[model samples]
Target chain A: MKRLKYILMTLCFSAAGLLQAQESMKSLMDERRENREANYAKWGPTSEHDGMGFIVRAGYVIGGTSPLPLPAEIRKINEFSPKGGFSLGIDGYKYFNMRWGLSAGLRFFMQGMHTGANVKNYGMSIVMGEDIVSGNFTGTDITETRMSGFTIPVMATYRVGARWTFNLGPYFSYWIYRDFDGHVFDGYLREGSPVGQKITISADNPAFYDFSDDMRSCSWGMEFCADFRVREHLNVFGLLDWGLSDVFKDDFQTVTFPMYPIYATLGVAYYY
Target chain B: MRKIFFGLSLAAILGLVSCIQDEPLNAECDIEQAVVVTDDAEAWLLNASEAVQDVPSADTTIVFYLREEFMDENYEGWDRLKDVAINFRLTPGATITPENGSAHDFTQGGVYYHVTSEDGAWQRNYHVMFIPVQPLTVTYDFENFRWESLERYCEWFEYSDQGNEINMWATANPGFAISKSSATPEEFPTIPWENESISGHSVKLETRDTGLFGVMMNMRIAAGNLFIGTFDVANALQDAMAATRFGLPFNKKPLRFEGYYKFKPGEKFQNRTGVIQEGWVDDPDLYAVLYENTDENGQSFTLQGDNVLTHPNIVALARVTDRVHDFDNWTHFDIPFEYYKEIDEERLKTYGYNLSVVFTSSIEGGAFCGAVGSTLLVDEVKVTCEDEDE
Candidate 1:
């Protein structure tokens, strides 16, 4: 009971500390916002300048040809076999005023690619004085490049002019799945198999491949869009969102593929 | 005016509440995001283990669950970002207990282990022990299992069809045995039961059409109790297997020589150095020899005697090479164990062992595969000795 009391006390103290820190941070932000408002007040007329209006737009985006070649090309170049999937995203936006608006919508995505091959060669040849077989040598030999993930876009747009709008945004993307496949054919191996088996290996048949949920995680990317309103309710636009950082839950290798799917959406939008 | 002020205050409070960001409506939010956080190191670990098909067959992976709490009443959107740092530690006595009663140390050799951290910024910690074999029943508390350091020998050979086919061979270091019985060819018609199972991973001469290679078992030969079967390369992957010997390599060339020996009576087997190669310079004069002897009944004994061979002897062993490319398919190569006359005499100073046959591979031929790698395989290996049941 005494121990429990101590634990509770410690937790209370921790919560108090967190609260204090948050208060200080909030205070600083409030002060900054006040200063910014004072500066803005100095720059312009305060009377209401614009009325609420509805606008509709439509546009087509020929997304940059994916930097990654087709699955076959990736597989051939890096021996990384790829599984094919499609990614399609459509977004709808509505603005109440020039600076205040909320866009609600969902995106559809499917992506995954992996390639694998077995290593099967062992033994040295006397005649050539070189490795006579295949897949018996072992070192850090990396093969096959694989990549996949899904994204959900949430954004806020500001109309800078009657025909032009600027969007400052954040996207929440969850990598649903990922796969890795490779091969190892080194002569040196643990003494046995998954089950203990001290038998002669017929061949260096080594296969490396994996598929898991571990690859999924939440990531932050930014979207910057400049839309040109062709009509009051219709506009053509281009959206580009680049991944500023990694999507890993831990510190590891940096993902170095297409950071953002830059696409031109050629769909129509309705405003009420 | 006061009423209007009250209304405005109420509106302000409502605005503050509305500005607060909401948490994911689904329980799967964090789980879905979890994949994004998997860093490269974690990916590598997963990939390596997957490559080798090493995974927990059960739900045994350690996990960290995070719950976010908003402290400030005005806590609003993602813009007011909070820096979150999470730390995970291995629980005390953390271990991987396989369903088969086998267990793994999650804090030692990292052979079957790895750790990765990345979820924007990464801070991860993990420890694991990788044993080459399984502990049948002994508890770790008893210190029954010990990690042994082995002086390993790794060599690669390659052969091209364009080169002149050559023959290569080499001898490996020898270790002591707990006990052994000798027998003649007539007495034991078949291979000894003790040597039935061969160590496929054994560092021995290999013939891959053109290239000759060698690998020596620098560690204790495990799983020899039921009988000293041939070394099994496949089983050594597990931690249960035992080690054999330790020593550095001296000869850079594939060992190839020929010699003869006859069994004697009432002699004890012990470690000894065989004859040295003829043309090769005897800088330290290193060679490998098998100890053998006979009993009063004329039965030959090839078991080790008291005096142990020095580590220097094992380290001094080397491969002899005439032409680097003189290594091809299995061509008969022999070594006269008596070649190391001085070393053999030293063995006479102790107890004399005889050489029945010799093995070798092209030790000098040093070429590499164009793209594909290579490996060596040995099957149906036998040792001839004098006849005797015990």
Candidate 2:
């Protein structure tokens, strides 16, 4: 009976200690929140990202360079043709109601795509960078392109049941890398095209067309995304980055067709 | 978690539904406009006393008809010459041969003009022939031809006629394949696929898929073709009406087009949208057009893909009816011309008409449709006259 009594007392002591430690941790956490609130009240926010959110994404960017207001044909996204890319950024949110909030973030999109096609006398114009000229081409030929950029998005978000979240907004992007490269061996280009002859354009011929500058410095588009909370501080998400602005400059008529960048991002987020 | 899952699913559906395929850019270079300058009081072309055809088309060709009175005594004792200094007005940044503004020696009958496109990537040659209007019936047997090479770029074959070499026979061969294969004309576009006693050598025209470039532009196939007139690169992307000239200036009222041909259409048909039309059988095109070569302004009219067969200027035309032909044997075709109006023999003998004989492995290839493997082998192409009967 004495031994039993000793065990019970020891268990009670341990429980007390655990409770005390929990109280201390809670206090510390509350103090930190208070400090954050105080700082927010005292100084203005400096970042466009939501005042308290972050996301890290690793997913394929599924899209192609196309004319604006994409056509039905482009709408049929080839699920297999998506390219590898990534997204990482922080955001700030302002909740107005139980289910209504606004958020903005500064993010970088490292996305790219490479697709192959067999067109018959594809009648179109090709334009390269500054050293430029537009030319028509027909016959069989092959081409590939890659692109990446930095983006800023402003979104309207809705939260449901404390575990579900949805966001829709417009995104602005500035490209850091751009390329439209390939070969024209099987067809003929009209005289006066930047690449004057029926020619092969590979890395070997640095003289090949580089359309990097032909891309617009700034682009804007609409997007929609959703997030599912996995833990108090962690969530998994998927997003769409739909561009509204043309990918080329206004005067750059070579790529006469209006094209925009529309892509998707699937990833995870750690938020405060 | 269930609500979150539902929301995510809804978003995914929206994303996919809102997505679309991008429209392709224009990647062609074609002559948008062409004109001839002169050294008369206003220094103009088409201003000669008897000049008829004047304004130029996007084909980079400028035709000027003279009254046979302007034949220069210095250059041609056999005929009078148009003593006007001729220049050119073409797409900005474009250049001309015989040096724009230089006096042309029309005494030799036909003066050749070469227009170098603004980008210096394409060139179109024109034959400015000044001859007394007469019956013209021509035949091509794929003989007496020579291939000219542009080093690693391209090569083309020329026809020898009228005591001179004619650059009239043009194929998209050099323009399409040379850049990638870096091949010469001897092996690239024409291989003289076969030789038959009736004609000697049959010209084989084959289509090819442009390797990497084809993928980028969505223009996958390059159909084999043989036709009269020049291929203007400038209009290829911007205007379908100006893309391919289906006819050339001719003064003859032809009654028939006789030729031996072998054909096999490609298995797939690819439209401008890049969709493969499965089970779509491609057909070879064998047709000709005879139209008023000059307009009221005395400007020469050249039929392009848009209006070739349907132009109001058409006076007569013909086309082969057989689409299915034996591959192992040459199929003889004799298509008679159908007249829309009575032949004005006198007017026809006065440079009043133009004709075109176009052959393609794919009938809709010019509009960006056809299978890649389509083939057309032709030999002993002849155009007979109806002088006595008509």
lDDT of 2 by residue, B7-125 (tens): 65446434544654454433333333333443341122222333333332333344444433333334332332445455455555666677766766665656777767554655667
DockQ (Cα-based) for each candidate: 0.04, 0.08
lDDT of each: 0.29, 0.60
Any runs in candidate 2 off by more than 4 Å, and if so which?
A1-272, B1-83, B87-137, B149-162, B177-191, B195-197, B296-298, B388-390
**Cα lDDT for residue A137, model 2?**
46
Tell me the lDDT of model 2 at B242. Answer: 66
Give candidate 1's total backbone clashes: 152
Candidate achieving the largest DockQ: 2
What lDDT score goes with residue A237 in model 2?
A: 75
Error of 2 at B242 (Å): 2.3
TM-scores for chain A, candidates in order?
A: 0.39, 0.64
For residues A1-272, what per-residue lDDT tens digits would candidate 2 score against the true structure? 99999999999999999999999999999998677655433332223333444455444354555445434323233232445477777777776644577888888776655544433223355532212323444443334566777788899987654566789988888877776654444344434442343332222221234456677778888978787777766777777787778777887666546766767676777766
DockQ-based class of model 2: incorrect
